[model samples]
Target: MGLVRLVVILIIAWLIYSTTRRWLASLDQKWDQKKSGRSEKIETMVSCAYCGLHVPQNEALQAQGKYYCSSEHQKRAESS
Candidate 1:
């Protein structure tokens, strides 16, 4: 009888441990997804026509329908 009780207790303990581990793992995965989702935006990248350097479109300078990394590049492109 004592042996049976010990076996049952060990089974219960293992079940509880496994359940807790799975729950914690799921929580961790959800946190990672939430954290990554914050910066998961697709930005439009444009290349500077003068030097072929790529930059995010929102931060690039636009002149004559061409993208530039800086004003100097834009002026040089316009001159050339």
Candidate 2:
């Protein structure tokens, strides 16, 4: 009886370990794919027309075909 109990416990442990390992591996793979996709995205760097500061195109404000680092700069340029 004691041997049977030990066997059952070992089987349960193995099953838990296997499932946990597979789940963690899947999570790792998903994270790696996400990271790779992000790295592959087109990164555009543009200089702010107002201050000549370099910033990522995606975050810069675009107006009149010019990129600005902030809305304040854009408004300042437009007002001037």
Candidate 3:
């Protein structure tokens, strides 16, 4: 009877350990996927021709075949 009880306890412990390990592994994979997905998004970097400041291409102003960080920079570059 004692041996049977020990066997049952060991089986239960193994099942719990296995389940927890799988759950943690899955969670880790999900986190990695999210991080990799974010890293996969590539953005073009541009430098402000006037101030030489770096900015994302999407946020920069386009003028005269050059990129500016703002309208002020654009105006300054155009004037110069």
Candidate 4:
């Protein structure tokens, strides 16, 4: 009877440990996704016409059907 109780206790302990490990792994995965910016909404990326550098569309200056990464690039493009 004592051996059976010990075995049951061991099983319970193993189950608890396994559950905790899985929970921790799930939390780690969520944390990694947040830290890596995977949890954020995807933005459209556009390339600068003058410099050929890629930037997010919302941050880029749009003019004349062209995108520029900065106002300076846009001015340069307009001048040239």
Span of ten consecutive residues with least summed lDDT in model 1? 35-44
Tell me the tens digit of each residue's lDDT in model 3 across 1-80: 99999999999999999999999999999999998866654346789999999888778899879999999989987887
Report the lDDT tens digits of candidate 2 across residue range 1-80. 99999999999999999999999999999999998877755466888999999988788999999999999999999999
Sort order, TM-score high to low: 3, 2, 4, 1
Task: TM-score each candidate.
Answer: 0.50, 0.54, 0.55, 0.53
Over all chains combined, what TM-score does candidate 2 have? Answer: 0.54
Pairs clashing in candidate 1? Answer: none
Order the candidates by lDDT, highest first: 2, 1, 4, 3
For model 4, where is the 10-residue window of minimal lDDT? 35-44
* Candidate achieving the largest TM-score: 3
Q: Assess the local accuracy of residue 20 in candidate 1 as a C-alpha lDDT between 0 and 100.
A: 100
Worst 10-residue lDDT window, candidate 3? 36-45
Residue 1, candidate 1: Cα error in Å is: 0.8
Which parts of model 2 are misplaced by more than 4 Å?
42-80
- Residues 1-80 of candidate 4 have per-residue lDDT tens digits of 99999999999999999999999999999999886784243457899999999988778899999999999999999998
- The true-versus-predicted C-alpha distance at residue 65 of model 1, in Å, is 11
Q: Write out the backbone clash pairs for model 3.
A: none
lDDT score for residue 80 of model 3: 77
RMSD of every prediction: 5.5, 4.1, 4.1, 4.5
Model 1 agreement with the true structure over 1-80: per-residue lDDT tens digits: 99999999999999999999999999999999987765553347899999999987878999989999999999999998
Runs of candidate 1 with Cα error greater than 4 angstroms are 41-80
